[model samples]
Target chain A: MKTQPLVIAGRTFASRLFTGTGKFSSSALMEEALLASGSELVTVALKRVNVADADDDILRHLGHPQFSLLPNTSGVRTAKEAVFAAQLAREALETNWLKLEIHPDPKYLLPDPVETLRAAEELVKLGFVVLPYVHADPVLCKRLEEAGVAAVMPLGAPIGSNKGLLTREFLEIIIGQSRVPVVVDAGLGAPRTPPPPSKWAPTRCW
Target chain B: MSFRPIFESHPWDDVKASIYAKTGADVERALAAPRRTLDDFRALISPAAAPYLEQMAQLSQQRTRQRFGHTVQLYVPLYLSNECQNICTYCGFSLDNKIARRTLSSVEMLAEAAVLKGWGYEHVLLVTGEANQTVGVDYLEKALRTLRPHFAHLSMEVQPLDQEDYERLIPEGLNTVLVYQETYHQDDYKKHHPKGKKSNFHYRLDTPDRLGRAGIHKMGLGVLIGLEDWRTDCFYAALHLDYLERTYWQTKYSLSFPRLRPAEGMLQPKVEMSDRELVQLICAYRLLSDEVELSLSTRENPTFRDHVVQLGITSLSAGSKTNPGGYAVAPESLEQFEISDERSPAAIAAMLRRQGLEPVWKDWDATLTALAR
Candidate 1:
């Protein structure tokens, strides 16, 4: 039997492999890999793409029927700046679905729980679908849920470290406790290293 | 928090020992990794990576082409003054050095600017010694206002000023600031800068933080290569760059490799960095961060400058004059440091074209800064 489809913010996603639009050598290669993976939801960093240009390479590649864009605020340091960037992205990309990522620390790129919670609450109140990338802190997940975020994305390891499932126990806690969809983001380097199959499996992994 | 804390926390000797301890295997691992870290940078710059020079150069060229395209930005330095209050041991403009001191008048500054414009130069770097009395904030403000209408982009390499002073100059078309730490080794720093405000290492160390706080568009960083162990000083510069990029995400960064050149009454270079080692360092910087602009100045010979252009260097300063009014007004003034590559800007541009790369003269505009304001 086929697995049930994942739904987030009233939208249905058929594929479990949510991909990121970074680290690829070229946009064409990224599009080829993303299309082959059959991912319906993809995340792109707002800072990485030139939103002012209508024919921006990243945006042009993601202009497919199956793909839904998730613009992320990756470079912003504070909640105030994140909110401003989210509004700009919404206007530029014509999408209200945002992946809230506030990593003031650029080296490890660990998410700031305080800024993420603040931005998520503000974004939700602004009538936008908020999906925050955060640490695998169960308490932060509950707080984000209380903030009315559409989804909570927690790291399995440091972003891009390829150290799979370092936070398995914490992921379990977040998955069990999260009321909204829980998307496992960052550090799941390989496709085979997903958490053990359980009733509380994550809605998506990227 | 600022980079000062991170910089102060790391002991110099420990970092040096760790860098010298890197092996060929570590360099190979760093080269093969999909992503690189500061540790990888250390490994890349280590002596172990010397054998892999060809490979590093190839990777650096590829990364540079990918990010900056086949284009080299062109700039010229207009030395505003040779006057100084600081007694820098290696500098020709030291206060104790017996030399003619001169600061260009408004008319003389325009005369120099006019010559640069005639040579099709749009970017100019204003340089002066650490003489706050003669060429302080007020003098700098006047110079910027006078030259703002003449150039597309303006940068300064003067004494480090307060954050408020930097904020004051940005609106006057101050696009970039080049502040070299000279050397990051504290003991060596004190030895080189024994007198005046330049002797205050902490204040100079925190200049980049002030520039960042002032909301500058760009800043260039480096350490004078001959003062101490080149490898360790570069490692500290890379660390500072890492911290700045994170703390000031909006600001762009560039790196320069200024080896000590012979000048009047100059101290002998403590450590001589050979051409091959300098090439390796440049390539390593490119492989570390593909986006950081690498600039080559006229202090390098024509042959070496031509060779390194393709490796990773994104900017080049050609036909440089190191003294005030060296262009046309008064060419007899004592030069800052004798320029090695005396090729004119047009010749350099032709050389870049011969290599199938474009020479960009005006990559920025004042309107963008105006819009930002």
Candidate 2:
């Protein structure tokens, strides 16, 4: 059976497995794991890579044709900084695709809904395909959809906690009502831990 | 009002006494604690923690890698001027020193920028002495405007300016400002800087507050290590950083520890810190906050730089010429201080690679600030 490709902002992604470039001990290991996973859409933190350097290590390994870069504004705290960083990432990485994240608290890395909504509106106006990292709030998801985000990344749990779909109830609500693609970012511990496809099929685990 | 109230609350002598009184048990407790605090930091920097250097280094390496990855950021300093109006006891740029002062013209500044660009450097730190008449706000604005287009990141380490001055310069592509409180000891601070605008310790103490209010993207904080008791000074700096991080929740912060080195007729360090002690301080900082940026400069010898790269440092400066026009125009002029590691950018990059870490030269970009206008 042939599975349908995932489409985001007119770009078709063959693989729905989205990966992030962080936490690996070395670039070689990260590259190996990412290739083995066969993920087509990868996210890189703008703060982590030297965008101006042609030979940035993380970027050097991610130059495969099958992979598309989704630069994230991870360290920014306000909408103004997010907009500025999004434009910079677009200019340097040559991708209008952005993962808008504005988390003021450092302990849990929880996304700020107000700032996320504000930045999403501004970024969409600036011609960016913003996919905001936000909590599993159905109302905020609808609001982001109204603001023209290419997708909405709602948390399964607090980022990196590895608890596995602690927000399943909220996730079901968001997935049922979301007008755009839903990517469940963070907190899936193992490959077998994701809920069955009877819940929602297209919302990939990241 | 400012950091003044917090500064006034902590008596220097008492803080020193408490740090000295920390025991081996306190060190163990601090090491084992899940969430470290200001008191835990004291125990980590105390003499009792000296025996656990290897353990601290391992923990520090783990925390650093977990947060920053296996990478180090490289930046270079561009001396825009050697002019000064301050009389400081430790510096070679004091008003009493007899030397030829030079301020780069807009043309001369760009000439030097071209050299750094050739080296493939996108981050540049613009340095100047405390001469308001020559290298004041207007001069800094012009320098930023001239070099903004050529570099991805521009940081300033000149004399402290007002809140409004920082507000004006941020839109001109100034991303960071580094103001080191030479010493936190008020008496020694007065003695070291007795004859100029820098003599106003309170104004200098409040500079970071002003920068935070101006909404700078980042700021660097530290005390010149040899000025007072290193442990006490560092604890206060950590405390100050704690205050700033909570107060200026929106701004990012970095910390640099610059040991006083020899310069043209410079004063000797009152208390010399061993290389081992410096390593302990670096590890202690990482253990305290996994997020704060730790930077090492060229003042230390090459061997020291090589050894400490794995021990929690995230930023480094290489191929640094501390004198204005030293790179292209005037190589014979006097420098602010003698740089020890004197390696080229490529050589340093090679060194980082040899140690299994990637060297990053352009982690920032100009478009990050372009929209501020």
Candidate 3:
């Protein structure tokens, strides 16, 4: 069985498991893990990079010719902050692709549905390929798709709990109903299962 | 005028046991159900579901792939100030710690913004202590104005402000506010926050209500894991989020699991939430609301964060600075808490790519916050 590529914002990804850079022990370890996983698109929290003098440590290690940087507004909890973070990422990472996240709550760090919807509409209008991090509410997913989001990212669980699919039903509904791509972000666990559906298997934000 | 339901309160231990007593059959039933209800959530979070982690992950991944299609959202935190009045025992900025405190000046805030901008970050989370005079509403407003031009989105993590203050700041480009209840246990809450206005648990509990009333677009919620029973505290947090969502129907909500990371002058965490338990809790929250943003900060170790990328996490914070001007202004100052994963942005991005996830930036705009106003 041949696998298809997962494409977002004009990029193609061969693997289905998308990972984050935040929870690793060291950069070298994270780099090795990413290489081991064989992902094409990687997410780098803009706050961690000193995008200024090309000498920033994080950016330097990501110098692999094959990978593209996806700077995210992970810490910004509102629409305004997301926009500002996106602009910074664009200037530093030199990419127009952005992952919109606005969660006003600090403890749980959940996204603001209203702000995300509002931001999606605005970011798409701003010429950036907007991918929004949102809850598994199917209605909101549709709204985001309508607002022109490149994709909708719903959490499988909290950011690092490794608790798989707490919102399975709604995610199923979203997967069935969504017009854009469905990437399951956050709350993933060990790859203990027989690998995911190959290629166009659909709905995963690793 | 005391109107209340008389349903007997179940022992928290009982509820937790119930949460764990689920069977594989129950898990299958929960998984097979066409439309999930709260009962299904219970089964999914139960121990019986442990054997089905792969199945659950596959479903979660499948759903996520359909909606998000292989992408990951990235972000960073800018510590605005470390001058805390609240005595959070676990924090370096706890009032009683007597550490050297620092709050960013307008200039310092700008310098930090410049650094983040150069870092290719379009989002920013502004952080500070509960000190009002140095990092109060007025100071926040000024800092927002200074930063508005540099970044696309801005959020704050500081003292809880009045609805009017949030209203004012929203217009100035302040977008989100992260307020974590140190713990839900009212008594323990007092013990942890012995001094300062933060001790007023009721007031803090009612903060999201105030934020909702103020008509802010999004708000974040969570509990500090070490101070109380993670289960009960999390249940209450979920209850709070549920209530707030109904009340603030138009607003968006997210949750975080802040396991106690040892700080400069705090006691050891009382209740240790094991990795398995953390996974259960995250799954519980995910089962509760797929829409709610689940965030993992640099506080967590990298291996865990890496493992979870495909499970169920929506947003992540990397290379975070938890001190005032920690980015460029004053690198040596005190931090509210030490960040665990200190990798640079590029290194993190490379890791994400290897996982087959695309990093996203510039997802929102200041214009949207103004629209809410």
Q: After superposition on all CA atoms, how large is the RMSD of candidate 1?
A: 7.8
Model 2 Cα lDDT, one tens digit per residue, B1-373: 5788888899999898999899999999998997799999999999999999999999999878766777888999999999999998888788889999999999999999999999878889999999999999999999999999998899999999999999999999998999999899999999899899999998899999999899887899999988889999999999999899888876778899999998777789998999999999999998998888899999989999999999999999999999999999898999999999999999999898888787777666666665443
What is candidate 1's lDDT per residue for B1-373, written digit by digit as tens? 6787899888899999989999999999999987789999999999999999999999999878766666788999999999899988888999999999999999999999999998988899999998999999999999999998887789999999999999999988898999999999999899999999999999999999999999887899999999999999999999999999988876789999999999888899999999999999999999998778999999999999999999999999999999999999999889999999999999999898888776777665543443333
Model 3 chain B: worst 10 consecutive residues (lDDT sum): B1-10
lDDT of 2 by residue, A1-206 (tens): 01457778888776777888876545777888888888888999887677656887789999988788999988676789898889878998999999999886644578999999999999999999999999999999999999999999998877755678888888888888877888888776567775645547744321
Q: What's the lDDT for all of these models?
A: 0.87, 0.88, 0.74
Give a tens-digit lDDT track for model 3, residues A29-78. 67887877777668887655656547755567678876777778876666
Q: Record all residue pairs in model 1 with backbone atoms less than 3 Å apart, i.e. clashing.
A: none
Docking class of 3: incorrect
* lDDT of candidate 3 over B31-75, digit per residue (tens): 887556556766776667777777777666555443344556678
Candidates ranked, most accurate by TM-score first: 2, 1, 3
Q: Identify the candidate with maximal TM-score.
A: 2
User: In model 1, which runs have C-alpha deviations exceeding 4 angstroms?
Assistant: A1-206
Model 3: residue B373 alpha-carbon error in angstroms:
0.9
